[model samples]
Target: MPAARESLLDAARTSLARRPWSTVRMVDVAALAGVSRQTLYNEFGGKDGLARSLVRRETDRYLAGAERALAEGGLPAAADWTVTRARENALLRAVLTGCWTEGLPAPAPTAAPSTSPVPAQRRADGPLPTPAEVIALVRDRAVAVLAPATSTAGARATLARDCEVALRLALSCLLAPAGDGGTAGLVREAVAPIPYGAGR
Candidate 1:
């Protein structure tokens, strides 16, 4: 069942690369996955469910990257990792902002509006897990990953606050990218206050 679900998600992802999520159809996904439409429905309940699952999967991937970065054990290392991941994954920026419209070119004026409604779960304001919520989630995960790297009681107490700063700085860099030294400089500035131990 997990493999079948993954296959459907893979098909959906491929379709999404070619077209907007608003236009992706479950039937096409099923066909691409070599499964019956009923099977797709059974697995995901509907398009909205499928979309949520996809978002969750992508979020997990992003967090995994973040965990690996924090495991490297220094503010500078984490900053570099965050910036690199943002550059490599366009989806990460979109997820961080709760808006997926970035990087996509505006549709031609003559193009017809999609007949399909935007998923009801997604609103004009934005998607689930607002930017603040996402930042908090990332900060919490980062603190956990970085906790072992900190030695002093003072460092542990301040780790969460420091992570919040780091994540916010990274998001800012992603939204308004700086040239060459700009992002690295900003990251260093953000992490300057965070305490770290040797060999971490």
Candidate 2:
């Protein structure tokens, strides 16, 4: 079932590349996934369920990539990842920027499929985070990954602020690409803490 579910979502994403979600037929998605339409309904309950699941999967993947980027090189790397992914993934771009644009499915709250046998589908049907919520989630995730357990609350707060600065810069870079052709330098400069007592 998991495999079928994943395949369906993959097929849905591929179809989305060619057409709007509103026009995508369940039969086509099932055929593309090589499953019966019945199986599709059994898994997702309906098109709205599928759409919700698709958006959830996309956001989850994007955030996971952000976490990996953070682990590899902190905020600059994460910022770069965010910019790159937004450029390549339209759904993610919509999720981050609050612009659904034509052909992309916007995330929204949907009633959970109480009768769904698939737990994943039920979760997917739950209320989705808004673009603002996504921003907050990423900032918080950056803090959790960047700030260590030993760091004091004050230090963590400062780190969180830096994370927001980096995230905002990255988001802005997406809206307005840097003429310099990258996001890392901008994020690095924006988040770099001032040296203590430098003004003296």
Candidate 3:
């Protein structure tokens, strides 16, 4: 059942690349997924439900990338990875700002969803978080994940502050890509001062 739902979402995402979400149809997605229209409805309820699921799936992918980068050892590494991913994934940029624009072409139909385990279930009816809210969530999670690496109370406090700054720097570069030093250079410079903890 999970695989079937994933296939449907993949088809929907592929259709979205060629046209706006308003024009995407359930029949086409079902056909692409080799499932019946009823099955599609059963899986996602309707088009809006499907879209929300897609957004959540994409957001999860972005967060998974951030988690991996954080695991790579420090705040600077996390900043670099986050900036690079935002630049590469158009869906990430769109979800971050709640503003969709033409950016990178959508992934091919065969592309698979991220293999990272899904996080805790979210309420289906809640509205998606705004860009600022998303950043704050990231900041909080980063501090929680990285806090144990710090040896002193002062260093932990500083680490939390630096995580917030690093995320903001990455979001800034994503929103208005730097023309002079480039996004990577700018993000790295901003996060370079944060002390990295021993990998937990």
Residues 61-166 of candidate 1 have per-residue lDDT tens digits of 7777777767765545565667777677555567676556733322221233222233321321134465688777767776666666535667666776777776
> Mind sharing the TM-score for model 2?
0.91
In model 3, the Cα lDDT at residue 33 comes to 91
Q: In model 3, where is the ten-residue run with the lowest total lDDT?
A: 114-123
Error of 3 at 159 (Å): 1.8
Clashing pairs in 2: none
Q: Please, what are the lDDT tens digits per residue for candidate 3 over residues 1-200?
A: 78888899799888877777667789999999999998887776667667767877777777777767776756556666777776776677777766675432232222333222322112332456667777777666677677765358787667677777877776777767666666545655666654555232
Better of 1 and 2 by TM-score: 2
Error of 1 at 66 (Å): 0.5
Angstrom error of the Cα, residue 156, model 2: value is 0.5
For candidate 3, give the lDDT of residue 82: 75
Best by TM-score: 2
TM-score of 3: 0.77
C-alpha RMSD by candidate, in order? 7.4, 3.8, 7.2
- Please give the lDDT score for candidate 1: 0.64
